[model samples]
Target: MQLSGCIALVTGGGSGLGAATARHFAASGANVAVLDFNAEGANAVADEIGGLALQADVSDEAAVSAAFGKAITHFGSAPRIAVSCAGVGMAARIVGREGKLSFDVFEKTLRVNLFGTYNVMSHAAILMAELDPLADGERGVIINTASVAWQDGQLGQAAYAASKGAIASMCLPAARELAQSGIRVMAIAPGLFHTPMMEGLPEEVTAKITANIPFPARLGEAREFAMLAEQIVENPFLNGTTIRLDGAVRLPTR
Candidate 1:
């Protein structure tokens, strides 16, 4: 789809991958909405890109609905491109030295990563369906973020892996259902990237993770993720699939 003059909504647009995508979209002439739980961060990014910043929690239906409403109020229409990038990661073995993982921890991860994506996508699709179709009867595109850990998780990533795996597993069915409405759905399962999730790790641990990347031998950049999002939006035929942006790196079982 042509991005020029299009309206785009990016959840988790306050930081990391979401922020990068928001900036890219704005640079491409799209009117962008930056939505995040961190209102300050969202506002900062929005100011930089001349877009609207909405405070919202993707897991909270009311908050997400309100934010979308705000975006429509400000932009004069529903966003044609909606990217669900709001998620969290939790590392814990289902059964380890700590014994059984806390149910709360597991549930939180699933709620934010899996349900949150669904929440935003559902609302976005509803709005997109109401909009007039573009040149090729295309209503809009939805992009979701998954992780390579969903497929090749190492030790202590049960919650994170399961949440991401759910996203990857749902892409095709969701895309198929939305196809009738001219709405394309796709997912990106990213490997190690330079995001806040990795920033919390110790230096040595981060370096070890980077060493696993066979080619570039480093962490993926947020811009790389944004580039793929742009491509998925532009390539109409690329639907109902999950693309792995890991630089050919697959994690080993530890």
Candidate 2:
């Protein structure tokens, strides 16, 4: 579906990829809603883009439902585009030192990354199903964020990898199920991007990380990710898959 004149909601819009996407959607003529757990950050981005700001923990079902309701009330319609980017990247080995189990870390990672994406997508699809279809009977599109670590997960990434892996694995089935409702589902698996997570790394450490990437041999820009999201929204046939935005880099085991 075309982005112009559409209503778009982006979770985790307070910073990083989501922030960039919110701005891009607004620039593309879509009425955007910026949702984040960080209320202040959400407000700042929304103010900058002239879009609505919503605060909620994506993993909280009631909070997410309420956020979507508020967005609908403010925009006078449900979002035609919903992007799920709110997630945490906590890492831990399944069996850490001293026989400490990482169950808590695992549970939290899945709750925020996997369950959170599912919550947003479910709500978005429901609302989209009620909307009038656009060209090709398209009602809306949902984009989710996954990580290259899903497949290239290094040591100390069991929790992170499993959460992201579930997202990647859900793409096709979700698209198939939502197809009947004229809603598309897709995911983006980004590799080593220049997000807030990478901000505090030492220069030498950063260099070592980038050395694995081919070609540009640097971190992917947030805008580049936004560009791909736009491309997916405009291309209806690009559903039911996870597109890797990594610079052709397969991560190594640490």
Candidate 3:
């Protein structure tokens, strides 16, 4: 489906890749909705992009409902593209020298990263199913954020890897079920990228991290992630799969 004049909603759009997506969608002539936990950050990006900003924790169903409703009221329609970028990062070994990892950490990560995606995508798909399909019989596209660690997790990434792995695994089933309704589900597994998640590292530390990437030998840009999201929306045939935006980098046990 063409993005021009479509409505796009991006979760965790206050900053990072999500923010980049909101901006790109606006530039593509889509009415954009920016959802994030940080109201200030969300407002900032929304102001710059001329999109609606809503502060809502993606894990909270009530909050998500309000956000979507507000966006619908503002844009006069449900979003044609829903991008899930709201997630948390965690690092913990099952058994460390200090002690066993806290189950709370694992639970929280899963609740937000996995459950939150479900909450948003489920609601968005329901609304999309009710919309009139395009010439290609496509009503909407749902884009989820995974991580390269899902499959090639490094040391101390048990909790994070498991959560992201579940997201990656969800694509095929969701697409299959939503296919009848003309809604597509897809996921993106990004490698190390220049976002707040990868910030605060020393120069050498950052250098070492990107050294694994075979080409370009640098961190992926947040805009590059957004670029793929736009491509997925425009190309209706690309569904039911997870695309890795990593620069051909595979993490080993490090």
My TM-score estimates for the predictions, one after another, are 0.97, 0.99, 0.98
| lDDT digits (tens) for residues 55-155 of candidate 3 | 99999999998888998999999998999999998777777777875688888899999999999999899989999999888999999999999999998
Number of backbone collisions per candidate, in order?
0, 0, 0
Candidate lDDT scores, in order, read 0.93, 0.95, 0.93
- Cα-lDDT of candidate 2: 0.95
What is the TM-score of candidate 2? Answer: 0.99
lDDT per residue (tens digit) for residues 1-254 in model 2: 88999999999999999999999999999999999999999999999999999999999999999999999999999999999999999988889899999899999999999999999999999999999998689999999999999899999999999999999999999999999999999999999889998978999999999999996889999999999999999998899999999999999999
- Positional deviation of residue 181's Cα in model 1 after best superposition, in angstroms: 0.7
Query: Candidate 1's residue-wise lDDT over 24-65, tens digit each?
Result: 989988999999989998999999999999998899999899
Candidate 1 Cα lDDT to native: 0.93
> Pick by lDDT: which candidate is best?
2
Task: State which candidate has the highest TM-score.
Answer: 2
